[model samples]
Target: MVAGERLKDRYAVDHLPLSHQGMGEVWPARDTVLDRQVIVKLTASSVMDAALAKRFRREARLTARLAHPGVPAVYDFGQHKGRFYMVMQRIEGIDLADLIAEHDPLPVSWVAAIGAQISSVLIAARQIRLVHRDIKPSNAMLERSGAVKVLDFGLAAIHGDDRYSRITQSGDSLGTVGYMAPEQIEGSPTDHRTDLYGLGATLFDLLTGRPPFDGPTPTATVWHQLQTSPPRPAALRPEVPAVIDDLVHALMARHPQDRPPSAAAVYEVLAPLARNLPPIPGVVSDQPDAIRAYAAMVGQVPLPAHHETRDSTTAEYDDPDLATRQAEARAQQLATTGNPRAAARQWRELADRRASQFGEQDAAVADYRLRAIRLHAEIGEHSRALRQLHSLLQDRIAVDGAGHPTVQAIQDEIAKLTQGGLDRSER
Candidate 1:
């Protein structure tokens, strides 16, 4: 391929890729059809394994599903000359890794802002059941507008989808060293929390000008990720706050269960620290950024309410059973209309009523409790969800043996919630 060489007679790409890594190469291209500069990533022909091709296609589809400003928009996907290529919105900025190299020990507020932005993206990704398995600094771009865009979902995994085979065999790790969580290094089942650990390591690097752990060899580095705890950020930079240090440590906890409950929870802690950000000399401009200004206005828009109250004089529920049925109907209406917060509240109330009318251990009451838990989780209320799950688990274990499938399913939910930082105490 050469400069001006057209792929599918539409995208004219440069002769050489902008960057080439192990699995693929990213090229700068002009989409003649759309008349825009876009990024085209192609899998390396030498390593075009069937599974890899499937994963590449999966990445394109998964990335396309994410509709957030923090993520690049996918434009097209097709095969040219037996190689798969995906076109995405071109992001003009330096990656976080390069930014860190040029300006290490970045301003504290800048680090907080970047982390918080990434967390905001993660919150969206988690809700959609997508996990970015690779989340190192190189996978994050810092635009001139000071917005952080997370890239590289090539290794992303969908929750509970096993149609695609595992990329790594037993005992083989897949992510970049230093950023891999302990479970990742051990080849254990992973979830959204894995990304949090990577974010923690990246933030540590940004604050200290070096990775939290670096060994003489890759094998040694993997070992450190599995067995060692990183040094405190305050130790390297005295200006670091104790609260920030603690948050970073919790994020990098050896056990996933020890980390914060969710990305939303992490954002809550970082939002206050992200104030008064100091601009990077070259990366962030001093002039007012139109993207930032536009985003501020868009975020302030309120979502339309889905719930409406009926007048007491016109209400028709005269009996307890009828009122319970009406409440359940309202809860379902709210849930289907995309208002999980109000839906969760209604479900909880229904569960309480069911428990009082029948019994705490009644099957109908348990069902209502489960619905409440599901609705809470849909709205990023993992802490509340975990509390309800624990209650359901006790009832389940009493009715079924510990090894029973239903009992085990509840246990799995508990583990996932806790590992993502939503333990019983969080309630």
Candidate 2:
């Protein structure tokens, strides 16, 4: 929240903030261990209800699942002083919104390239059954290498994952009015093709320097998207190829079933046109980008067979139950065995991993960390036990406030740990 302040005692806040959006503020930061620049996004406030916290946790899991060059990497999800924070790779690029403004009606090739790049990301998302509900221009970044990085998974959802936390009230759905699909605007169930409609609107903007359907007010804009036929980009910008025009209309079809079957199918059409992109003067840098070269080689690899999962929530994340359950179960078994230190280490690792997911303020994190301290104390590592106890106490106080019951409980635990003892539950 302030310059020079640190989150998790690892990420040092480098500046005030890069920008502020609807959910919270985005700050520029540095990862001390990796020695790399990162961006930290925080919630508007530390106080969030159960639903909001669930949504925040789901967003972190959702974005982390979308591992791709086109998506910014998520580093850590945490909390400090009750504020939930998401640490992500800091992508340097001009927003597509700004790019469109500076060079309205971008060259036909660039339009194809941008649309193709966006479609490529959507293709990746569709593979995992993830729907990026919001796919407008501002949510995309045109990198120096001329590649587009799809940004903001805040509105993303996985298909068949009906347990998603509601980000809005009962009737209100969150989305950009001009770009939302008819079903999305109507609060009807949405899927991958929903994102295709948004892509159509984005490409329409890139081609004609305006949204496909516009009106004087947001209400009117919603009506246009819901009722009016998608405008032909070629009619507004004669230079737009008719092939591209037909593709855009297909993507923005009123019925989801009528849109392009898949984002990959859409990409197949746009990729050929994306060739030989001439760089824009100020928008794209002349510097050689290693990622671009690496991507060229990656393109040659054969695509995996498309998977259509019905019950899965995340795309293709490694089995956490296999990873977490086995480790914790083994740790529990190891607790009564000859090696106490190894068990302690296992508990500590679980604590750290969960801390990365839920933050240090989490009760489960405190529980496992306390287990580690208890084992350390049992093994006569008194100093280490005391240190961890004190650290947990500090975090509890920060998150729960000084006078809260949990803080008081943590204070008592620290006192007991210093005295070479722990509660029966901790033991």
User: If scored against the real structure, what TM-score would every candidate get?
Assistant: 0.71, 0.70
Give RMSD (Å) of candidate 1 vs. truth: 15.7
Worst 10 residues of 2 by lDDT: 309-318
Clashing pairs in 1: 260-421, 261-421
Error of 1 at 236 (Å): 0.9
Q: Each prediction's Cα lDDT score?
A: 0.80, 0.81
Candidate 1 Cα misplacement greater than 4 A, ranges: 168-173, 299-427
RMSD of each: 15.7, 8.9
Model 2 local distance difference test score: 0.81
Candidate 2 stretches greater than 4 Å from native: 165-172, 302-427
